[model samples]
Target: MKGRTKLTGLVIFRGDPGYEAARKNWDPHTDRFPKVFVFAQRTQDVSNAIKWARENKVPIRPRSGRHSLEVNLSQVNGGLVIDTTKLNQIKLNKKAGTVVVGTGNRVGRIANTLAKQGFIAPFGDSPTVGIGGITPGGGIGPLQRSIGLISDNLLALEMVDAKGKVIRANSKCNSDLLWATRGGGGGNFGVYTKYKFKVHPAPAKATVYRITWPWAQFEEVLKAWQRWAPFVNNKLGSELSIGPKKGGNVSMEGLFLGSKTEALRLLKPVTSVGTPTSSIIRLLPYTEAVKFLLPPDPILTQRESNQFSSGFGRKPFTNKAIKAMRQFLENVEGQFAGFFFLNWGGAVSRKSPRSTAFYWRDAQFYVEWNSSWLKPSAAPRNIAIVRQTRRKLQPYIVGSYINVPDQGIKNSGPVYYGANFPRLRRVKAKYDPKNIFNNPQSIPPANHKR
Candidate 1:
């Protein structure tokens, strides 16, 4: 452990003052006990930590927003954790239509910052989710229908490899590395320090709508949405949330890229469905519209004991799939359980599967099944419900979203990356030959021993 003794740069061990707080992640299911935690403040710190882990023969994991659904991927028991939460710095170049953001910057902060400057970038809905994790995992947010995935907008990145070498990847240099980072999944590559993204002009005024129906109408609403949302205008991004089982409601919320008048006109067919309990639509400045999407309190998301699984719908939801979903909801005993569908098409589908490292271009919409429990005893049942829901829809869905990692996926390489896995392995071999940066689900080198 000579290397461990030599390690420096704001290291925190077992009984350190902030050790308890620092070890916690967004998901409560992950209970890891690392021997050491390093709060890296600069690119040099990240490099040094990697070198120390290698020399000391200790496993390591780099953590940012700590939002990985597969908790073990970000926490290595009895190993070392290199935290990049202090590297938050942002610079926006409006003239170039690009922005460089530090690894620690959260999605909400990034969105609000860009909105004020009359620009915006596609990112996740959560305000506290970090850019470091989302960018590489193929961020699909409300604006994806128009602009594309956050990975699609990534222009460049800087990272520290397993050997403690700082490298920059972009169109001009290390182009392969840049391609892999786009959607290869986070914590698989080296520790990311910064990302430069192409931003789009903020619309003059946008429409935000939230339409809801009683729980009894979930089927009718879902059927219409499964067919309509995917083929709807490219300028619109819509999502459906059906949940909490017995007493929950079914709702559809979306954003339109044009005036409120046009948005409503386009949504006429959808709105004309069964009696909606509530229909609220409004037009606001681009900045205001963006703000409306933020969850009331992101901190609550971290405290929820939840399991999230995802799948891609390549075709319309079949009658059997719909029936399965209804039965699943009817039998729910958990305090909270739901399914969410995010529209996928337009700009997202316009790109070929090989265009970037992300490979799910043929999906109609992405489906997320989530279940939450209040006590430890309720976990097994809730988890079973979530898994069963995924199983029922397996025949109709293709692949899963990397961002919403599911522990049930025995072999995620094919599901998450599809045909892009081999290329990702090559990139892993080239950049991290020693396999110093790795996890349970990280991309393995072409000749990896493990």
Candidate 2:
């Protein structure tokens, strides 16, 4: 460690004033009391933190936006958490039609930033999700079908390797590393600092729509949506949510990259089925549409306990499958329980499966469900509800999304990366041979089989 980079950022030891707040993640259930937290202000700070952690023989975790959903993914007991929230810097190249952004930026910030420039970038539903985490796992949202996953737009990235050396990856250099980072999942190879993304010019105005139905109409509405959503015009992207009978209702919300007339016409299939309790459609500026589609930016300090599971639907759900879903929803006791579906064709499926580490390109739709609770006592039942639902729907689902990690899934490497797992392992070997960066489900170097 003779040439080790000294820790140069805001380093907070366990007993520091902000240690309690710095150690918390988006979900309270996954938070842990780390030995130290380093809020990285620059790339060198990240490198120094990695070297400092190694010098002290402490586990290391890279965190941004603190939105990691699973335990130990972003924070660990007695570990070093390298926080990147302060590295948020946005540089737009209008001439090249691209943007180079710090990985620490959140989804909502990027959306709002790009919108102000009259450009748009793909983003997920949650405004608080960090780009550093989501982009690697194939970021999905309303713009997926229209603009492709955030990873698909990725052009280059800068990362600090296991040895605390800064490196750049793109199509020209360290190409394999670039390929893996596209969809191979974060915390596998290195800690990303900056990302160069191919951005799209935004249309002046777009249509945003929301349709709701009584909870009893879940079956009919779901059937209609599944049949129509994936095959609809690529310009339109939609999501359907089926909530628990206790405190939920069926609803569909989407953004159409066109006028209200065309959007309503394309939505006829689902809109014609169940007698919707209410329907609202409006044409608004692209920036406003983003605000309308996404939930409000979450308070960074706010925390909750929750269990989440994810999967891909290769084909439409059969009656048995639909019945199973309904049964699970009916039996779930929590008010914060529901299933979310996103149509998954269009630009997402245009690329070959092997093009990037993301391999679920052929899926027709994506589905995920969550069971959340405020009390620690409710953990068991809530976790069981999600696990049981996954078991019942296992036959109809294919792979799981790495971003939405589910600890219950055995042999998750294949479930998340499919055939690309081997290549990802090789990349891991090349970039992090000793596996300096690792988590519960992180890929092992190729020579060391799991």
Candidate 3:
């Protein structure tokens, strides 16, 4: 028994066969195989691992959903990886309209569970994305316009500090940590074992609209979408997608949160912009909406190229910006890919900028100039496309999304947290001064000079 239960969790060394599974992440681009993966089964196990890593001075990487864009949080060459996937448990409170979720749960599973009870949680575009990671990174998804980002709905969080002590944060206790947890990227302060969400009743049915436009008419559709996209109805969650599709054509995809009849009426202005190659709009059960927005978890060797930048749109896309977008869309080789634009109003903007650590309160749209490189050699070319596209649209953009960062910027503290970076640094130093929660993106202890 001396050797057993050294930690309250299952600890596997470098040669363990299970290490292969624990080392991998969702993104197929980079392969990160950590030397040791401590599968934390409980909060006590998490605390034990923290003390071990601290004494050994091992660089620690925290993970739950491993749905990370950058390889930092998922891989640490020879260091220890504290895996929270095993802490899979959920405690629901229907009366409070909240649920404390295990970090291990993915958006799809959580959404399905909650939807059964007529409740919905804010999730990312991918259903497989973990709630642990997205909740802290200012999660925005199909329901953002209705319930707002996942952060907005966050009521409290339970985290294990760098010193192996567990604490809960919210408006009442550890208010600063609460602020940092809202919009600041996760895995910084400590290992978040659970998240309490303020969920809401979902619509009985949602309407999704898909309209494809030819490559030849990209400019006209692009110009018109820029004008009408930001000012749409608050209840109507909308987005305009311009990207490569099958047969070398561009696609314009959109989603609305109301009846198909009302959606058709709301989309009249959009249809008038240009003739869609194929337009389809309909109302379906709230659960079916998941298929249209985020298809079921399909196992594929998928590679994503996201220049994770963000921008706010206070006014309509100007002629200059629209013309610039047209030029960039026309410049692409038009392969099988996509450029996405998500609406930022409705419930998303209801909270003020300073309400939580996340900024971009008044901004109306989040432009994710993302691409998918199916092949290895295509990575460089795809990156260049991202740069060129953003360069053309930079004037009209403001900030970037941490979920899909460019990887070029070193000071991600500013890029990811924006105005909230400084406070985040202080929080990191206060709770994790020893830097037990160390990773490339984890908040660096701010006490170095203080």
Candidate 4:
């Protein structure tokens, strides 16, 4: 146990006073009882923890924001958890139009902080997700079409490799590593310490709107939204949702980076579909729009048992695809079950597929479904519903999103990375040939066989 003396930061063993609290993740379904948790306060601490885990032959899992949705991704039984939540830091350089941020910061804090300085960076929907995990997974949200993905803005990063060595990657040095990390997913390469991003100034005012329709109009509204959202003005980003018959309705909410008049004109296609039950549109400052578009800051310790799966839509849904969606909504039985959709293209499609590890650049829209329950006994039924729905829509969807992972996927490499899977494997082999950083679906070295 000589390596134990070498570990630094706040170490909590299994039987320690805070072990009970330290073992939890955002989703109760993914929680595990790890042997120890090392809250790394600095990059050196992360390097020390990785070396200690190797010396003791213990598995290692890197954690930030505690928001990993899948089991064993951020915590493992009888293993070590290296947490980077303490590495939170934000530095903005107005002259250079860039920002260097610690990977430990949450999405909400970064958005709020940047908005205060009259700047904006791409962000996902949930404010609680860590930048460390999201950036590598091709972060997408309301600002995606306008500013590109969070990964696209990533200019450089610092990481601690499997051999407990610190490394830097950017356009000039370790450039291939930088390319792969942009959208290759987290915990596959190494423990990222910091990210240097190219940021943009926020618009003076933006328009935010929310429109809803009766349950019966779900199919009509969906068809209209799918056709219009992706082709609408690039400055406008929209999301559509449909839920079960028991508690959900068809709704669309979004942000338009312009005056309300321009937003209404561009929204004519979908907004003109059916008689809407309600409509709310307002012009607000950029910061206010951020608050309106994103969900409220989350309670980190709040937990729920849930199953989620996602795919990219290369084109508008066919009639059969729409029918299948209707059937799922009509039959699903859960208080928290539904489908979520976001328009793709615009700046996202401007980048070639091979330019980065995120190869779904041609996707016209992105769709995902989730089933959640509070009771342990309800897990099977809820999980089955999502799996079944995925199968029915498989023909129409191209690939799955790594961020919204589904354990049911047997061969996940191609499903998540597409044609870029081979290149990613080569990069993995070069930096982590020993395969020290891995999870259930993590990329394996090219020399190793599945």
lDDT of 2 by residue, 1-450 (tens): 244557789989989899887877778899899988899999999999999889888899999878788899999999989988898999999999999999899988999889878998888878889999999999999889988889999999999999999999999999998899889999999899999999999999999999999999999899889999999999998999988988799999989999999998999999999789999999999999988886686576554577999999988999988888888888776665789999998999999999999999999999999887788998888898889889999999999999999998988999999999999999999999999999999999999968
User: In model 2, which range of ten residues has the least summed lDDT?
Assistant: 295-304
Residue 122 error, candidate 4, Å: 1.0
Candidate 4 lDDT over 1-450, as tens digits, reads 755538899999999999998987888889999989999899999999999999998999998888887788999899899999889999999999999999888888898889889998777778889998999999988888988999999999999999999999999999999999888999998999999999999998899999998878888888888888889989899998887787888889989999999999988888898888899899999899888877686576654677899999988899898888877788776665788999998999999999999999999999998887788998888888889888999999998989888988988999999999999999999999999998899999998986
Predicted model with the maximum lDDT: 2
Which ten-residue region of model 4 has the weakest summed lDDT?
295-304
Clashes of each: 0, 0, 5, 0
Task: Compare candidates 1 and 4 on TM-score and give the better one.
Answer: 4
Tell me the deviation in Å of residue 421 in model 4. 0.6
Q: Rank the candidates by TM-score, best first.
A: 2, 4, 1, 3
lDDT of 2: 0.90
The better-scoring model by lDDT among 3 and 4 is 4
Q: By descending lDDT, how would the candidates be arranged?
A: 2, 4, 1, 3
- Assess each prediction's global lDDT (C-alpha) against the native: 0.85, 0.90, 0.72, 0.89
Worst 10 contiguous positions by lDDT, candidate 1:
295-304
